[model samples]
Structure formats: structure tokens, C-alpha cells
Target: MTTRMAAPMSVTTESLAPSRSTETACFHCGLPVPPDAPYAVVIDGRRQPMCCHGCEAVAEAIVAAGLTDFYHHRTTLSRRPEDLIPESLRGLELYDRPDLQKSFVRVDGEHTREAALILEGIVCAACVWLNERHVNALPGVLEFRVNYSTHRARLCWDERQI
Candidate 1:
């Protein structure tokens, strides 16, 4: 049987928040934020708009850590969602453990398994792309896809590879 799972997002750095005069991009990932976008948060005394819930969550996580200064100190754009991830998700190795995988994984068929994960800090389309690439690179991973709207990842892998 096929099973479902969660996924992650990506982020970028910028010097300042966009002014209200034009379309505003997400403060963290630079994705265009619609004026009516509901995902937003206050950071460093400024309210910032986010392109998606994942971006908003990442921004809030950063702010909560007293690391709002990261925006100013970032020397390069974050290449993966993992880069912007807070302390809660510092290690990616948890997924490699059988005990942890049991809760998220299910039998898809003979020699196949599926897992779902909710990636809370995704910030952009590139984040999803990077996550898929990263997960698919795993030796057992046969396919990996992340839904940006739900922050969920659906991973299919060879059971024997575990």
C-alpha cells in the first residue's frame, strides 16, 4: 500500500523588508508575497510577510531563538531549507533510524516502504526542490516529493536499504 508523509522548505537572506508601495517578497526566502497572504510574523520589531506558512514558521523560529541578527550577518543565500532550520531540526540523521522511521513509515509493497514527514521551516520553492534532491540522494530512496502547500514529504524507498 502507498503511504503519505511530510516535507521541508528553503530560504534566502536579504538586507531589508520590502516597502508597502510594491509587491513584497518574503523577508527570509525572497518569494513574492501576495498582499493578502495570511502567513506573517513580527521579527526584530518589524512585521514581515511570508510567501507561505513554512516561511512564516521559519521566520518565527529564528526570531524566537534571539537570532534575528542572522539576517544582517548572513554572508550568502541559504542554499537549502536545512540551513534556515532552527535548533529543533538541527540533525537530519533521525530519519535514518529504524525506530523513528517506524512511526512515519509503512509498507508500500514487497521490498518497498513509504514515509511522511512534516517539514516545518520551508521558505520557498527552491527549498522543496533542494529537499527532494537531498532525500532522493539517499541510497535507498527511490523517489521523494514535497508539497509546498502542506509542508509534507512523501518518500518511497527500498525496504532492504534500511
Candidate 2:
């Protein structure tokens, strides 16, 4: 009589292990966050995220002491949502005037022209990235950099195309 060998168990191991945790880094202290350890607060019409209540309180104290730059620098570096601007409804022509002339100073003709734009309502890097992407899509824009602290964007473009 031939003996029947028992079939090997096909048990999957994934069900036995714990589920992966979703964690975000704290904006202020750079700690791993399990929940909403980083609390978002609105200041100067801009939403900012802090690591904890202590950091938030410290931020408030700094603002109360008129140290606005402290907050501005910190908030600018943090990952936050951009303040949406209705570009279609706004007059972009205002930025094209002689006073706001698009010009660049280059020692050699080999260099391209650079222009600085002061964006009024920019709040985060996403806005900067979006604007940069759109502007770069234009025929002549070569490169651009956004300074969140100053809410400004510097663009380099070919003069012939502009």
C-alpha cells in the first residue's frame, strides 16, 4: 500500500505581519509623526505647521516680540499648501510695465536675460513649482528659482522670445 504524503501548507505570511505605518516628519523638530504631531496654524494669511504645542507657543511668542523674520524663515522651509491665485482673473500686464521692466544685466552677450517677479499670494513650494512649470512651458524660459521667504521668482529667458 502506497502512503499518501500530506499536502504542504500554502499559508501566506503577509497576514501575520503588522500593517505598514504612515508617518510624516514634524516641520519644526524634524521628528517622525504618527498622527497630526505637526499642527497647522494660520499666520499673516499663511498656513504654517509646527511640531508641537510648545513650538507653536514659541512661534507665537516670537511673533509677539515682533521677530517676524524668525517665523517667516521657518514657515517658508516647511512643506505647506500653496495659497491659490486666480491667474486667469488677475491682470498679469501690471507686471509688464516699464517700472517692472523685464531686464537683465549680463557682462557678456552669451548670457541670457533674467527677470524678477514679485508674486503677491504665493504660500508654498507647490505654487513655486507650478508657476515654474507653466513658465518653463513657454517658448523661451530657460530656468527659474523661487524664494519663498520673499515671495519672489527669478526667471531666465531668451530676450528674442520675450
Candidate 3:
């Protein structure tokens, strides 16, 4: 008896995934979202597709911080998730929002603000010192101090300069 073999078939994400329009992009990084892409984050009470786990993590952090406006004010798509940042720096721009500043900043003068901040992941004196030094070096930073025991940071700055 002679046996017949079937032809080889190739499959891509588009083929395996459900159908979607070509215009759909990742809400976080502007990458094209594969039809089958499963990673997503809820933003503004709607599901937003993510390009990868890194983007998803960053989005979740933003949403958790009540900075969903970060999505609204962004001028450019974020960098590739792998290239984003240290956990602490990922959402720096979100702080520009007045709502976020309200949580930590006290108006000390017409142009100055003092922010009481909780420094996360600071486990040692060196970490506190490093943070203090760097923050103090920033332009417009009038003062910066970190308490090793409490990981609380008090920062004074000229809002116009930084």
C-alpha cells in the first residue's frame, strides 16, 4: 500500500489569533498588537492592550497611582518595555499632574513647593544617601533629605526650575 503525506502548513500570530483590524496598536508602547495578544491593562474603565509584560507592569503602576491622566498627556509613545526604566522612575512624568502633586506637595510660596515623599525600596542608609545626593543635585532642588529609619523624603524645589 502507498501512503500519501499532507503538505506542511505555516502559522503566524495573525493566523492563530482572532481577527482584528490592522489599526490596533498597543496602548502603552504604540507597537502593533497581535490579534492574539493576551496581555492587557484596564485604563479608564476599559481594557487596553499591551505590547508585552513590561508595558503591562508599567501601565498597572500608573493606574494604581491614580495617574491615568498619564495616558492623556503623553506626547510620545513610551520606549520599549524592556528599555523603560527602574521601577521608581517608570512613571516620573505622571508627577507633573496637579492631582498627583496634591498628594505629596505643599505650597510653600508662589513658585515653590515642598513635597513629602515615601521612598520605596530604600532598605539601607546608602540608598537614602544616594537618593538625597541625586535629588539635591537636580536643578531647582532647594533641599532634599531622606530619613533612613522611615524612608520618608522631604524635598523643596522651585516649581519653575524643575
Q: Which candidate has the top score in lDDT?
A: 3
Q: Give me the displacement of residue 118 in model 3, in angstroms.
A: 0.7
Cα-based lDDT for every prediction: 0.74, 0.56, 0.77
Q: Write the per-residue lDDT of candidate 3 for residues 1-111, one digit (tens) a residue.
A: 995433323212333233456656777777777677788998877788877776887789888877776676566677774574688777788988999889889999899
**Best-first order by lDDT:** 3, 1, 2
Ranking by TM-score: 3, 1, 2
RMSD of 1: 16.3
In model 1, which runs have C-alpha deviations exceeding 4 angstroms? 1-102
Per-residue alpha-carbon lDDT of model 1 for 1-162, expressed as tens digits? 985332222333344443444777787777578778998888656677778776776778777776666766666544437566888767777777878878989988999988887888899999999788867877899999999999998989897985
RMSD of 3: 15.9
The predicted structure with the larger TM-score, 1 or 2, is 1
The TM-scores of all predictions, comma-separated, are 0.40, 0.36, 0.45
lDDT of 2 by residue, 1-162 (tens): 995533322322123222444544443434444464556545454554555765465556655565545433442333322224466746766765655563533322554676766778898889988777767877877877788889977878776777
Best by TM-score: 3
Off by over 4 Å in 3: 1-89
